[model samples]
Target: MSKDQTRRRILEAAGPVFAEKGYDAATVREICSRAGVNLAAVNYYFGSKEQLYVETLQYGRDPEGQHDQPLTWPADAAPEDKLRLFIEGLVRQMLGERAPWHRQLMLREILQPTGACRQLVERHFRARMDQLLGILDEILPPEVPLSRRQQIAFSIVGQALYYRVASEIVKFLVDEDQRQAHFGVDQLAAHILDFSLAALGLHPGLAVPRPEVTHEPLEP
Candidate 1:
């Protein structure tokens, strides 16, 4: 295989392994086996298992190659539009099926951080947080304290993440037939956008369906 192809294969294989077993429990031999490459390939490319694990985390963070795309919208896009886009992106990153390890690895880090945690935060988490905070600054009044703005940004992120982190509970609480309709990523994103806008005292301009009238008597 070409040098770049080999590196990509190793990274793709390593992501799920690290996510499944974490850095300490995951083995370089297993990653090599999964990638169909010799053990020396890892050492040659990344120099160490720890370095490989960090690159895997970085790959998981941007599996869709979003970094290659324009990182932000046009300068004239409304703040609300940017906020909606941010929320939707978060929902997709957290729950999208195309790269399950992205969420799994993040959860693993949260439960038990390792040497890789610092690099992951510096490379991915902090940058994303700063972007969200910048968007929040535009939406919130200038008089609002930075601390309050940070809290609001966290609030929006927390609301979106709850659906991902507590998804099993959400599935249990939701009716089986309604699960996909209600809890799908796009649906969750819309709900979060509407809910957040409402909380901010801004209308999302999406119509809300009124409750259906029923002639059935109430249960005792």
Candidate 2:
């Protein structure tokens, strides 16, 4: 393989290992084996396991580094629209069918932060957080403190993440029929958007229609 190909292979192989085992327990030997490269390749290419771990995380989050930059919206777009798009994008990124290890690695880092956590936050998460906070600033009143706005931002993200982190619990709480009907990506996104907008006084709360019930006469 070419030099770039070798590096890419190692990264691809490393993400799932680190995500499943975490930094401390994951071995460079195993990563190299999975990549189908000699063990020396890791040391030669990455210099050390620590550096490899950091780069592995970066690769998982965004191999091209495109996500480090803020996303653009049309100049005339309404703040509510911007917020809806942001929420929908976040929900899809978490819940969409993609590499499972990507979200798993990120979630592991968040729950059990390591030395490399700072780099992940700086490179991948900072811009996204700023974007969400900017949206919240527009919808929330000026009287709302920055701290409160930050909390709101966390709340919005937490709602989306709950479906992933607590996926099993969600399945248990919501039956298959209900999940199939109301738990689709677009459905969840719209519900979250409407619920948030209503809470912020941007729109009226959603009114879910009650299901019809049939009754039999006691005599019959």
Candidate 3:
């Protein structure tokens, strides 16, 4: 295989092993073995186990991440629509190509964050949050504390992630496979917009209150 092809094989192989075994437990030898590449090939491509882990995730995230720099939405679009596009784009990135092990890998990373995870949070996620908060400023009063603006942003974000990250437990709680599957990111995105409107001290009759910020930011 060509060098790029070889690298692709290694990253593809590494994702599941890292997820099944975790970052510390999973070794380069094991990932190489699974990829049918010699040990040296990994060092040749990624230079280290940590970088290889990043390559594995970048495979899925790069498309979005590459284009995911802060956006200035159209002058015509409403703040609500701007918020919706940002969220929909985010959900697509998280659920990229149904790369499921990413969710497990993410849970592992979040529970016990590595240096790389910290960088990702600082670079990718925090950047998004800052941008989202700026847009949210129009609807939310300026006097609202940064904590509460974040709280509002998190509510919108969490609604988008619940199905992908916590659906197994959520499915069991609901006890309906059909309903569980239907509880998709699209529906989550739609629901969150309504939730966001209510959170800015306005009452939307019959809107369910968000319980609390319990789960960490789901993959996106």
Predictions in order: lDDT:
0.81, 0.82, 0.72
* Residues 1-220, model 3: lDDT tens digits: 7978888889889989987788899999999999999999888999888888887766644523564344568867877778778877666645455656765676567656776756654565667788789778876767889898888788777766665567578767775775546556676566566566666544453345456637766776
- The better-scoring model by TM-score among 1 and 3 is 1
> Best TM-score goes to which candidate?
2
RMSD of 2: 4.7
TM per prediction: 0.77, 0.81, 0.70
What's the true lDDT of residue 32 in model 1? Answer: 91
lDDT of 2 by residue, 1-220 (tens): 6899999999999999997798889999899999999999988999989889888877867878665334578857899999988988888876886646876777677777786658765655767898898888777779999899988888888888888778899999999999998899999998888778877878755564324424536564
lDDT of 2 at 127: 72
* Residue 215 CA displacement from its true place in model 2, Å: 20
Where is model 3 poorest over a 10-residue stretch in terms of lDDT?
60-69
Clashing pairs for model 2 are none
Error of 2 at 174 (Å): 1.5
lDDT of 1 by residue, 1-220 (tens): 7989999999999988887787888999999999999999999999988888878888877766665332577778998899889999888877877747866787677657785657765555677888888888788889999898888888999997787678789878888889866778888898899888878878633465425535568669
Give one clash count per candidate, in the order shown.
0, 0, 0
RMSD to truth, every model: 4.5, 4.7, 7.9
Q: On lDDT, who's better, 1 or 2?
A: 2
